[model samples]
Target: AENNRRKKLLRSAQKSIMLWDPDGPARKPPRESAELLVSADAMFGLSDSFQRCTSPDFLLHTIGGTTRGAIERAYDWLIPIISRLPDTISRLPPSTSCFLLLRAYGADGERRAQLKELSTPLLHHVQDSLRGTLGEAES
Candidate 1:
């Protein structure tokens, strides 16, 4: 009975919270598209997982020598400046969004090459880890 009442209150609270927002209903992510993940509440936009390489170690190492140089230039030039503004603040502000967009336009060339290099190593480790985990889970 106590748990039931608490659950009811939680549900009501959630409903009330949702009502305060003007953006109709919240939509889920497409999960595979390259859309900007902006939110009025977000301090920073969400990140993307390139080629399913979401792991930090994988990203840090994968993001490359010459490509890293390019990205470093872009990162310095872009990424952080625009990632912070709330979508509704309104106006052309100096944000990393444009830099990132510009970088993204070129990101494919270097990123693809970097990804190609990282892919084999990443797949090998993922396959190995999944095998062990799946085996353990099955047991």
Candidate 2:
């Protein structure tokens, strides 16, 4: 049941990502795409869903060659939610966190500073967690 639910969420996220294209001829307008991306149902468990559904190497892969406008629009909608993630949720792998920060900060300079400030404690927590895990392994 849990696996089925996760698969459903993955499919839904993929559909949402496809529909979010801002430049495709049949795509909705940028504003609408942004709105859809931020909708609660659309965004539920977004980070975990994405991480489970796609390998990290391919996460955000589509945005790489896309126009900055499309990437920026997505970031605009995503940043607020990303900022509010609890420490438990925000405890993403280092690479994932870096990718998120790069996109979030690239979209809004002001947020870069705020996110940096907020991440300090989260980073320390993650480091401590890693240390504990390593210590247990060693013991």
Candidate 3:
């Protein structure tokens, strides 16, 4: 039952990350784009939950060793959205950043290096944002 639950959660995460509207004659409104960004953030949070609920080996197996690729693809999808909303990247919850780092750590050297390259800026952004927030609270 637990395994089934984990599998279901992983599938759901994959589906969320894969959600994208293809370009059409009519462009989506700004609000729809904003909603996509919000959904991506929620998906990241959900991915973090998956990281916490299962062992690294189990997760890799469950996702058919495609977790890294999925994460990278999600990052690609998110960057444009983030560029439009500069503050959005920094506002990502710590769990999302932590999970990315943790997965990087567990990966083989090539994937580890790739994930680190992708996550470094994000980690720094989150750190800076937290510091700024705390500083404001003290003022």
Q: Please report the candidate that would top TM-score against the real structure.
A: 2
| Candidate 2 C-alpha lDDT tens digits along 15-63 | 5554444665544335445445546545595655653344552334533
Off-target runs (Cα >4 Å) in candidate 3 are: 1-88, 134-139
> Candidate 1: worst 10 consecutive residues by lDDT?
85-94
Clashes of 1: 4
List lDDT for all candidates, in order.
Answer: 0.36, 0.49, 0.50
What are the RMSD figures for all models against the true structure? 19.6, 11.6, 16.8
TM-score of each: 0.22, 0.34, 0.31
Off by over 4 Å in 1: 1-107, 134-139
Sliding window of 10 residues with minimal summed lDDT for model 2: 87-96
lDDT of candidate 1 over 1-139, digit per residue (tens) = 9778655644544443322235576544342211222222233423333222334433234333225355465453123322332221122112222223344446576554443443343344434444665425533
Instruction: lDDT for model 3, please.
Output: 0.50
Choose the strongest candidate by lDDT. Answer: 3
Can you write out model 3's per-residue Cα lDDT over 9-101, one digit (the tens) per residue?
455454453333546353334544445554665668654454334344333333333244654545533444334443444444444444565
